[model samples]
Target: MAKVLVLYYSAFGHIETLANAVAEGARGAGAEVDVKRVPEPPRPAHHAQAGQSAPVAEIGDLASYDAIIVGTGTRFGRMSGPMASFLDQGGGLWAKGALNGKVGAAFTSTGTQHGGQETTLFSIITNLLHFGMVIVGLDYGFQGQMTTSEIVGGAPYGATTIAGGDGSRQPSAIELDGARYQGRRVAEVAQKLHG
Candidate 1:
């Protein structure tokens, strides 16, 4: 079976929810999955408010996974600092080309409809490409991107969710569905490549 890792950084749990959806999808595709969160700076108040904890990702040996799905919150049209920091630590892996041939995908959550979700996803994708991984994305075929009646967040780049200006709005069902599709598609691609 393919091994897939869903790595993410979530401050208020929005991306965490989306990451779980992605892991579920990958599992459904018959892959063994690990859903982990990149270590973030201490946020005592935020953690208290969130009232939950996530499995912290250990930085090492990324080459073992057949696929990697990265998710993060947007920061001025870029990835969150913690996620960026975690990825920056992958320089050793990059030098060794340890992640080459792995399937790579990205996801994000923004505080507003135009809050740099695509840019954040692309930033993560750029790093994946640097590792020589094959990119996977949520395409128009998902149908979630075609919805016009309500605001949603899925694009050819990846899946995303709008968390609202105050970080109150949660991901809509369609958004989660889009995330699931991306995860499952990535797992499928990884399985084929592994074969």
Candidate 2:
């Protein structure tokens, strides 16, 4: 079976929830899945990351997976600081092309609908592309992203969720479905490429 990793940095648990959903879908698609979190940088005494129980990921772990799905919330219309810091530590991996030919995908959350979710996905995707990984996105086949009757967050770029200004909003059903679809697609692609 292919191995898949769901690596994430979630400040308020939204991305973490989506990460689990991604893992579930990957597992269902017949890949062995691991869910891991990026180490958090030192912050002020306030605002601890609550309930983030996944084992912290090591940079070398990225090479072991047939596919890697990255998750993080957007910060100031970009990828979060800690995830950026974690990924930046992998120059040696990039130099050696450790991630080359692996399937890579991205998922994210934002505080507002216009908070640059697609941009954050691109930020993660750019790193994967530099590592020479094959990029997979939440393509239009999901169809959940096209609805207009309610607020939702899925894009042709990747799956996403709106966390609200205060972070109270949880991912809706459609958002979680998009995440699952993306994960399964990544795993299926990985299986085809690496099997």
Candidate 3:
């Protein structure tokens, strides 16, 4: 079975919810999966809200996994500081091209419809490229991308969800479905390439 890692940084609980959906998809695809989060300094205000707690990732080597999916909350059209800091520490793996040929995908949460979801996903993709990993993304086949009646987040670039400016809105069922598709697609690819 392919081994997949789902790593993410969530300020509130939305991204964490999305991450779990992704993990479920990956597991359903028959891949061994590990869901983890990057460490960040405690923010009491953010912590006041209930969120899923994941073990801080101990990524000693990226080569150990056949696929990796990263998610984060956007910070002004970019990845959150904690996620950026976590990726920055992967220089050792990068130097060795340890992640080369592995499947990589990204997801993110933003505060508004235009709140840099694509930019944040692309930023994570850029880092994955630096590691020489093969990139994966949601395809047009996913019906969630065609929704025009309700506010939802899913695009060809990656999966996403709008958290609202006040961080009140949660991911909708359609958004979670898109996230599941992304995870299943990545896992299937990883299985083909590495299993």
Candidate 4:
């Protein structure tokens, strides 16, 4: 079976919610998903590791998966710092062509409609590109966008969730569908590429 790595760094829980939806979508598409959280390092009483990036909540070996779906919260029109840092640490993998030709997708959560959800998704996608991964995006043809109960998900770029002003908005039915569709698409593409 093909494995999809659903990696994320969620702060206010909205990103985490989106990650679960993405996983569900992958499962529905007949893919095995390994959900991994980037591990955050413990805050030191004193300033330790002056040049280190922010602590990750979890981490995993990306080479183990056939595809990777990264999710994060939008921060001022960009991916969160933690996610960026994690991507930066993937240089070793890129140098060795570890993730080459793998299917890649991105998703994000934002506070408002124009809160940089698309930008965050692109930022994540850019990092994946450096690893020679093929990017996957959401298409309007999917019925989920038009039939969803709320306007919480879907983008020309990829799957996303509008988490609302207070960050408590649940993902709409359409958004969930979009996520799953994207997941299935990635799985299908990976299978073809691998075969």
**Top TM-score: which candidate number?**
2
How many steric clashes does model 3 contain? 0
TM-score of 2: 0.97
lDDT tens readout by residue for model 3, 100-151: 9999999999999999999999999999999999999999878887989999
Query: Which candidate model has the greater lDDT, 1 or 3?
Result: 3
- Candidate 1: deviation at residue 188, Å? 0.2
lDDT of 1 by residue, 1-195 (tens): 999999988887888999999999999999999988876577532542354465787779467799999998898999988888898999889988889999999999998999898899999999999989999999877997889999998889999999998889999999999999999999999999995
Badly placed stretches (over 4 Å) of model 4 are 41-60, 146-150
TM-score of each candidate structure, all chains considered together: 0.95, 0.97, 0.95, 0.85
Candidate 2, 1-195: lDDT as tens digits: 889999999888899999998998898899999999998787811354676789999999998999999999998888999999999998999999899999999999998999999999999999999999999999999999999999999999889999998888999999999999999999999999999
- Give the Å shift of residue 91 in candidate 4: 0.9
Off by over 4 Å in 2: 44-46
| Native-to-model Cα distance after best TM-score fit, residue 41 in candidate 2, in Å | 0.7
Identify the candidate with maximal lDDT: 2
TM-score of 1: 0.95
Model 1 residue 174 lDDT?
98
**Candidate 1 segments whose C-alpha is farther than 4 A from its true place:** 42-53
Ranking by lDDT: 2, 3, 1, 4
